[model samples]
Target: MTQPEVEPVSPRPSNLNLPNVLTTLRIVLVPFFGAALLVDGGDSGTWRTVAWVIFFVAMATDKIDGDIARARNLVTDFGKIADPIADKAITGMAFIGLSIVGEVWWWVTILVLLREWSVTLLRLSVLKRVVIAAADLGKLKTTVQGLALGLLVLPLLDPDLPSWLETPGEVLFYVAQVLLAVAVALTLWSGAEFYRGVWRQRHELRGSGKS
Candidate 1:
């Protein structure tokens, strides 16, 4: 008896879904967020606060869109690509804006951005051949980075604030700096791990092919 023919499975069509919309919205907000942060040379307390709110909203949408996509099975290629780009764009803006304002050092921003974009590009390049899930270290790095950036985005240390707030604001500012240090360390470590995973996986794939 002859076996029946099997149809090759076609790729699912990308839809104009809520997750993709949110991802696009995030990218659109990046320039606005940067503008708000840089207003008055990042010295205006009001504008700083506004920028913080915008950053918060953008980050919130990042989480919400991922959750909704996973829950509703709305994941698509666009979401996978655009989502990370949107994330890096907003965070990159924050890092550059903060450095411009003298809140963060130029070297720190340069190192972090280099690591971030390098990792992002490498991952995208090998995405078709290898899949690496988010590790706990990466999650921790993101959380710390976001908290540090968000706190620094606030006008906490602005000298124009009330005298009563001066001490607390300074304290918070230092705290944020400490968190940023930790975040940078985590970022480098996670990047190393990711590269190692890719190397190991590719080696294993080559070994299997040889067999």
Candidate 2:
């Protein structure tokens, strides 16, 4: 008699874990950060500084959550989906707020957001067919954007700050501009790379009649 075939079992996804909790916390902070920025009305004051602190903390959670998830083997489908959404929300708020407050140009915000969302949409479209992990270039892009936006969000330009800080802050702002430009370049480049990888995988699957 022939033996019965056994089906492979998938790992059960863990949702309620430390990483997911941190991820949720990051999402929750988004509104408060926006409120602070709006309340400050782009002025260099306590509220504006508070907003930056909120933003920084939120960003920090991103790194911590990912590390904890990987280290603890607590990765889940929910986390995979929620993490990117949270990231987009926080970063999107920063971009839009800066544009509204006349701190950053609208065009730059528009271009960066367009690329960011396009890549995200691509990921969703191919999620079933391929698992494309983030590339080094993608992480680099994120880091650069974080640094650039963090610097821009700071009220270091405020005259109330010490005279010494004003000069350094101005210099940091200029450096942030350069980083932003680099980030935009990497964003477009990495996006193209992702598309190429997806196309190749899809093509292979099609050739093998698995797609």
Candidate 3:
């Protein structure tokens, strides 16, 4: 017997949605955030506070956009492409700007950026072939990185802050540094895990092809 015709799949959601708008907004904010962070050679408490607020807003939108997209079934190719790029652009600016201001080591920023971009590019290249889900370690890395960067963006060591804040601010700065160190470790580990996952999936595909 002949089989019945299958219904056509629904078209993808439009790219011009709130989620995408938020993602684009995050990208647009990168330069402004960097400029604020670098004001007065990174010594302006007020500007640093402004930078921190921008960063926080950008990061908040990152989560908000993703949640909105998923909840409303508004996922699209544009979001798939722009979401990660937006994230990297903002965080990359923070890293580079921090290094420029001597808040973070140059080597650390270089290493993290290299890994982040390389992995992002590779993932996008294989987007059609591989469906590697975000691993727990990767999520942890993201969380730690965001927390560390956010804390560092504040003018915790600005020297011009209130005397009462000196001790607490100093403590927070050191804690942020420690979190950054942990984030670096997690970043490397997650990168390696991602590569291994890609390799295993490709190997399985090859093996199946031979059969």
Query: Which candidate number maximizes TM-score?
Result: 3
* lDDT agreement with native, every candidate: 0.93, 0.87, 0.95
Better of 1 and 2 by TM-score: 1
Each model's Cα RMSD: 2.6, 2.7, 1.9
> Could you tell which candidate, 2 or 3, scores higher by lDDT?
3
lDDT of predicted model 1: 0.93
**Deviating ranges (above 4 Å) for candidate 3:** 1-8
Question: Per-residue lDDT tens digits of candidate 1, residues 1-211?
Answer: 9999999986674669998999999999999999999999999999999999999999999999999999988889888889889999999999999999999999999999999999888888887888888899998999999999999999988989999999999999999999999999999999999999989999998989931
Residues 1-211 of candidate 3 have per-residue lDDT tens digits of: 9999999998889999999999999999999999999998999999999999999999999999999999999999899889999999999999999999999999999999999999999889888888888899998999999999999999999779899999999999999999999999999999999999999988988888931
Q: Candidate 2: deviation at residue 45, Å?
A: 2.4
- Pairs clashing in candidate 1? none
lDDT of 3 at 207: 85
lDDT of 2 by residue, 1-211 (tens): 9999999986775799999998999899998888888775778567788889999999999999999988878888888888988898899899988888887889989998998888887887788779898999999989999998888788867778888788998888788889878887888999899889899998999999999
Superposed by TM-score, candidate 1 places the C-alpha of residue 176 at a distance from the truth, in angstroms, of 0.2
Top lDDT prediction, candidate number? 3
